[model samples]
Every structure is written in C-alpha cells, then in structure tokens.
Target: MNHDTSSEQYILVTGSGQVLAVSDTAQSLIPHISPLLPDLINGAGEDTVLLNGRTYQIHRHLLKSESGESYGLLISLQQTSAVQSSDPRLGAIALALSDKLEINHVLENVVRFAMDLLNADAGALPIYDPDTDRLLPGHLVNLPVDLIVPVIGQRRGLMWQIVHQGSSILIADYADHPAALPELVQVGVRSLLATPIIYGKTPLGILAMYRLRNEPFSESDRELLQAIARQTAIALQNARLYQRAIRNADERFALYQASIEIGATLDLEQLYQVIYRATTRLVSHQRFVIAIPTENRMVEYVHIVTPTGRQAPQQVPLHCGLAGYVLRFGVSLRLSGAQALPEPAVQLLPEIEGELADGSLLAAPLIVGDRIIGALLVWSNHHDAYTMADLNALELLAATVAVALHNAFRFAQIQSQAITDNLTGLANRRHFLQVLHQEMERNRRYHTPVSIAMIDVDHFKQINDTFGHIAGDYVLREIARRCRQQLRDVDVLARYGGEEFGLILPETTYEQALKATERLRTVLATTPIMIDGRQINPTISIGVASFHPTVYPDPSSLIADADRALYLAKQQGRNRVCGVQELTNDAQP
Candidate 1:
C-alpha cells in the first residue's frame, strides 16, 4: 500500500467490512485500512496507530440511516507526528528545553510551549507532589491573579481525574462538564483539555489547556499535549536529580565546617552553638531546641530559640514529650500538618501553649552507637512543612553532632578525674593548695582579707578500726556532704590529706570565719549518720584563720596558722572551733 502525506485519508466501509466508497487521498492506502476495518469500527471513537513509519490517528464516524440503525462507517486517518513536525514552534520548544536543568525553568517552558502549540487562551502545568498528595501550581499562563486554587487534590476535577486514571480528558464546553470550576465557566472559558504527564511508569503531573472561544479541542490537540507532557517528565526528573545533588553537596560542606569547630571546642555551650549553626544549614525552622536527659529522668531544655517573652520549656519529664520520645527510641520523628499531630506530643507539651499543638515538628536523636545522649528538634508553623528529604538532612546533622558530644563528654570526665577526690567527690589535696595559692596572690594585689580553715575528724581512726574501712569511707563522704552544705558558694572545700580538710573563705575576717566554721562543727556533730542500720555519731574539730596582709606572708603561712589552731582545738577538746586570733603570738602565723 502507498501512503499520502499531503492530507488525511477517508475510507467508507459497511458494518461487515465491505468497501462502499473511498476518497482520492484514501485510494493509495486501501490495503492498510482494509484488514483493520472490523477492529477500527468497534474501537472507541478515536485512536492512534502506527502505519508503515508514520503515526496516524484513526477517527471512527458511524453512518446510520434515518432510523438510526448503523449501516456503514466513515474512518479518517491523519499522520500525527509528520504533520506536527513541520510546525516551527515544535522545533523551538525542543531547542528551548534542551538546556533547561532547573525545575521552574523547565515547567515555565513546557506551559508556554503547550499554549503556543494549541493556540489556547491560557495554560497551566501543576506539578504533582506525592508527599502532600496534591497537585501544586507550577507554572501558569494568562490566568487572573488570585484565581488559581492554592491546592488541588488528586481525586477531584478534570486535572485530578487524569492524574488518578492516567488518561486524557477533553471538556469541549465548560458549562457542559458538571465538575468544571464555576469561576472558569463564569469567566467565559469555553473548553478545557487535561492530560497526565508520564515518563515510563512514573506520573509527573498534568498538562492542562484552556480556550476562551466556543471552538472545542480535537483529538489531535489531546494527542499533541500528551506527547509534550511525557517528554517534559524526563526534563522534570533531570531537574529534581540536579537539585538533590546540589543540596547534598551543600550539606556535606556544612558538616565539615561544624566538625572542625566542634572538635576544637571543649565548652558545652560553645559546642551547642556550633551544632545549632550547622543544623540551620540543613533544616529551616521557626524554632530550634536541644534537649538532654538529666539524672532525675527529666528532659532538660538546654538550648531554645523562640519568640521573646514566650515561656519556653526549661525542663520536663524525660519519659514524656516528643523530645523524650525521640531519645528513648533513638529514632527520628517527623510530624506534618497540625491536624495530624500526635495526641501524646500535645498532652506532654501542654505548657508549650498553642505553638506546639499547631505546628509541624521534627526531632532526631543525638545517638552514638546504641546510646542516646540527647535530641535535636526543629519546628515550623506551616502545615506539611517537612518532607522525607528534610528529615534525612536532619539525621545527617544529628550524626555529626552525636560524635562531637561524645568526645566532649569524655574530655570532661578526664578533666574532672584529674582535680577531684574519688573517695569524697570533693576537691583533692593538690587542687586545694592550688586554690589557696591563687587566692593569696589575688588578695595580695587587692589588699583584701582571705581566710582559711583546717578541719580534722576527731577519733576517726577508732571509728575506722572498729567499723572497717568501708564504714570509714562512708563517714568521710558524709562529712564532705555536710561541710559542702554549710559553706558559701565562694568558699572552696577540699580534702587536704588523710583525715584533714581545707576551706578557703574569701574576704572573711577572723569573726566571720569562726562563726561559719562553728556552724559546720555543730551540724556534723548533731546529725548522727545511720549506716547499714547502725547509728554512728561523728564529730569534727575546726580551725578558723583569717588573712592579715602584714601577719601572713604567703599561702603556707596561712595554712600553718590554721593547722596550729586545729591542734590546739584537738588538745583542748574533741568538738570545738578555735580561732588563730586567740592563739599566742608565738604560735600565730
């Protein structure tokens, strides 16, 4: 059979496949349509088929007598691609889209090209978002301001029908379609054509065209629009991949910078700030918070960013709240839309007021191996605010911060061990002398008075010998606790050696030192510590000394005066407070 590229071919055949008539254009294509006549007559009104090397659209028109009984069929065949290939706008659209790598640019070109190709009054290409289950307006042409719907679900209207069914829809008259947008009908939109944009097995979105005149869209128009939409899907896929690559590169750089700064930081506050900054690079938010668990099983809100005067949560039960949930399970939590917020988060964060109940939240645990150290959270007021990609970015930031926090904790443990007494959890002897020397140097420059006291546990050896070393350790611990409770925050209490403790009282005179020291002596002796169901009454003798610029030459002299006072107190009685001022001049520093 020969083909005619000049015009559409027409063939008239009976219902039983007998030829009745043929157009001059169809004379050359008799053999092509003869065998397919029976199938073509029964097929839906319009279809496309490949003949030889050209794609042809076959339109079936039923011929009936006056009684409406079908007798013959008039079939029309037109080459689709070959005819449209001659249109210069098709070439221009192809060339314009060849270099577009951005999603917005690709969408803009696709819509404008569709409008130009169909000579429609306006157009729009709404991109499909699977996360939100909606088609969001991507690009529009010649539409009035405030007319486009903010969002359209995938189950309503012509555009959504095509989205759900993966097919094309042509509404020849706006008033004829029951589900047509009333505003569009009122604005004199005569027709609407929508087709799903698909790439292989994936559906990207819809390509919709609008016409203002009474002229309806033909099958050729639907075929052309569907073809362009499928091609646009490929470009859309490329643009998304490019965007993800660029975003990933940026996140990597932020993590690298944060690692360098955090590794050099030993201060927890400074490290928190670095983590916050690094997180901002990955996740945008209206509020940011960092929470860590306390010894009492509570989540302490260590850092928070919120509006002024809003009572941010400082502490809450660790087994409650969203932050606790993240840390306890060591998993990431992402909540989108206020309507979908979990009831438990709302109930736990009741004090957070309206903010927590009406926002999207994302929380990732600061975990090292199987241990959860804390949690990082971000919040936004908008519904559907975060996606899986956003959550993944947060998880990456959490991983980086987790390592830094672990190292910081290890460093603090080491530093504490070096200066702390393991037996009593007080300052050790070396740290005590170091503090005494520092105070003396500072007082010497300012001419301020500083005082010191040396305390000894009376009859400690007898108690230890009778009760065993474990009981002795318990008594020492109890003594340190009582001394710490009675001392001022400015004073430094330390285990000096064996059974002696040193206390530094800054700016205290002889009188103040004696009163404070005597109180400590009374508190320890009055409260009998019960250990393992046995009452053990313990007593301490305190020596109070003050810094006099002319009398005490250095830290050692001050310490010596305090020790002499202690020896005098022990000799006079077991439970008493003695002052250096009361000592003989020969015995004083």
Candidate 2:
C-alpha cells in the first residue's frame, strides 16, 4: 500500500494527533488534513471527508520501524472531487448585503452576485406574496423587463419546487423538467438553479439563476447560491424590522409633538390650528371635523375644516352620522369605499356627503374617563386610502386632543366663575371694580369723560321678609335680566353687591348716563316678576356719576360719588334716577 511514495501525499502525526511532518505535495493539504488525523487514527479503515469545499479520501496506517513498534500515524490524503472553496464574489456580496438597509437593494445584490458567481446568464429574485399565495418578481438581472415569470406554487415551476421543498434545485436541463414553464423555455433558458430564501422556518422568497446554454450547474454553484440566499434572507428580515422600528419612532414623535403644540394654547381657535398641523404629519385628510356633545344630548359641530373653507358650526342628533356612531359607542372606526357613506351618515352630514361618497373615513371618540365627550372625524378622497397604522396614529392624536380640549374647557369654566356672579350671570363685584379702575385710568390719561351708575333694588329686605329669600332671589334675578337688556354693547354691567348693581358707560356724559339709568329703572318697574303664582313688581333706584379731572380723579372717588347720588335717589323715592351734580348743587353752603 506504500508503493510510489513520491506520488502520494502523506501527513505524519504523533500518536496523540499533532502534525509532525508533511510531504511536499501534502503541505498545501496540511491544514485540512491535520484536524482529521485523530478520527482517521481511531477508525479501523479508510474514510472520505469534505474540507474547504473539496472532498478527500483518508487512509490511516501505523508508522513502524524495524522493531515493529508504533510511534506515529501516517495519514494518506488523496484528492477525490475537484470542488473548490466558495467564490470570492460570495465574500464581496456578503459585505455589500451587510451594508444595505433596504429589502429591494438587498434582493438586487443577491441576484447580481448569484449570476456573476455562478456564471449564469440571467437571474431573478422573486418575493413571496401571501395575498396571492405566489412568488412575485422582486429583482431581475439580464432578464427581459416585460417577461412575466410564472408564479411559484405547489408542484409548479423550479422556484416553487425549491421553496416548497425548502432546498436548492439544479435543473441541468430545464426542458426535461416537467414543472418548467413555457415562458422560461421561450426566453432561451436551457438550465436553471433555484434556492429558497428562508428566514428561520419561514420561506421569504426564491433566488434563481438561469443559463441560456446547456451548461449544467456544478454542486459548488448550487451550494454557493444557497449561501447567498441565506445571506439575502437575513438582510431582508433585518431591513424590514429596521423599517418597522423607524415607523414606530416617527409615530411616537408625532404624538408627542401634537401633545406639546395643542397644549400650548387655551384659546379654542388656536387649539384647532395646532391639532390640524400635528395631525397632518401622520395622515392627510380632505376634511377635519370636531363634534362635542351638547347639554340637550345633541352633537354639535364645534369646528369643521374642509378643502374649500371652514363651515359654520351646526348641531345634529347624537344618533346621526359616523361621528355620532363613534361617540355613542366610544370606539374607533375606519371606513372606506361604499361603507364610508352609510345611510345615517349621509342623512346627517349633508355638507360632507360628497367627500364621504367616494372617499375613506376615520373617526375616533374623544373620551375622558368613562364619558365620550365628542368625536374626531377625518375624510379622504381616495378609497381604502387609510391603513391600520393611520387609524392608530389618529387614535393617539385624538386622545391628546381630547385631553387638551378638556383642560381648555375646564380653564374657561374656572375663569368664568372667577369673573361672573353665580346668581345673576353678570360680572362680579371684584371684576366691576377692576373695569372701573381701568376706565378711570383712561379718563385721567386722555381727559375723556366716562360715566358710572349704581342701581339698587328698592326695599329688597322687605320683600325677603314678606315672601321669603327665594322670592327675593327671583326678583333680583329678573331685575338684573331686565336692566341688562337696556344697556348697550359697550356698557359694562356687574352685580356690585347684594341687591345692588353697577354700570360703566364708556364715552358717555352725565346727561347720557342719567338717560341710560332712567331707561333701566323703567324696564325693571314695568316688568313684574311672577314668583310661584304671584306677580311681584320690582323697582330699582339708580344714581349716575361722571368722571371729572378736578372732581373725581380716582376710581374710589367716582364710585363714592355714585353711591351718594344713589342715597339721594332712595331718600326722595324709589324707581328714580339722580345725578351727582344735582346732589352737589343741593349741598352747596
């Protein structure tokens, strides 16, 4: 077995399996043969092994001298198959695929590398389409642009066979294969090789290479193509996950920006603008509408923005329209095509009927706690234009909008309570003084005349004693209402104190103030407030005061003068108007 030692490649290894010497022809095979010495020495016969993409036959024999004692093992290495290591292009392609973040770019690189490394004339990367249950062309190299590759399915084309079996296939003669499509044969494809692009247990697509001549693909070619498909699968999966992560980050940022911008203002109009700008970042809409529930159980359109212009606010029943449906159920909705325009929505939202007829719609309830306060509605002019992602983004924005609106409404309520009287719905005493101070400051600066009046319900204590406090409150409320109806829009009316009211008339003289007070007195006296079943006539005594630079320079002095005139009117009789000038002339020494 040891004849012609010069022609055979041999490795000398110690009994413990470490290379001690290698023949001249075996030097190149040392690295591959050294690791297999232990297994060859332990085995009783010759064996074959694969190394560096090449097959080699191993023969192990005891190295003995004249004493017939074993000191080392002589491993005979004989070349079997001529397959070499992976093509250098595979390494470059792996590097290129690692740098790509887009799926299409990765697929293209896979096809190009497979065609160049395998020496194929044409190649294609077809992605699996779950919707069609087929493989669709993703990227093509040296393939006709208009050539339609047949879809991959069970017992179908070469690509389908590879994907279905989860293995690489080498069709040495595509014409002899029963599953070969005519389109491929017509394209002058004589041989083809396909490998399934698998990620984990799932098949993502197929990487296929075609040759125009009858050159059969080698085993190394099949192995290299499969390796490229594996790399391509990993690249594509990574790209898809990276894209999803980016989208999620963008969505979160949009919601955060919307919260900040919308919460920046308490003004209703400015709030609407911020909401619109923030929402446009996530989804574009042809029309935007905000509807809130009214006290009468009706949904009122508080804001509406369309492509043309904003519409006037209108009220609709709570059971009407898509917005109403979301409000009633407290659920989000995404409707497209025919379902976007239901009969109820068409009947209630006639203004937006055209938008709903041919477009898509998304709506989410503005919920605070367990209550559905309102609804946010958006419409687009394209059918099925919105996805679940869009709906989710809108819902996030809706939550922020609802919270902002709630805060603004609460702030308005608190501000109203701070300035208004709870009983009569007029400005309170503190606000009245503030307004008077402002007006007096204006008068002092510009030397302009401003008038003030004090009105008191005559004999209010007597009415409270006779008819009870309830009837007295009724009288006061009615008198305040009637006096308010007599004032101009520029005039300020306030409940100065219990049973007393104050009025500020801008740009009015003493005579004009007297006339206005007289009108308020007559209105109160003429209107009898019916309390419980009795008609009670109420009279108001009014006093007018004018701001003069030399006479009443300060707000307190002006108020004091008005009060003195009111005392004079009350002393004379109720239901009368008296001026400060008349009182001052009477008090002259």
Count of residue pairs whose backbone atoms collide, per candidate = 0, 0
Q: How many angstroms is residue 283 displaced in model 2 relative to the true structure, after the best TM-score fit?
A: 2.7
- The TM-score that candidate 2 achieves is 0.56
- CA lDDT of each prediction against the hidden true structure: 0.78, 0.78
Estimate, for each residue in 515-584, the C-alpha lDDT of model 1 and write its tens digit. Answer: 8899999999899999889999999998888776677777788788889889889999879999876787
Q: Taking the tens digit of each residue's C-alpha lDDT, what string does model 2 give over 422-532?
A: 999999999898988888888888867789999898999999998999888878788877877878877899999999999999988888888888888877778788888
Query: Where does the lowest 10-residue lDDT sum fall in candidate 1?
Result: 345-354
Best by TM-score: 1
Rate residue 433 of model 1 by lDDT. 86
**For residue 389, what is the lDDT in candidate 1?**
85
| Shift of residue 420 alpha carbon in model 2, Å | 3.0
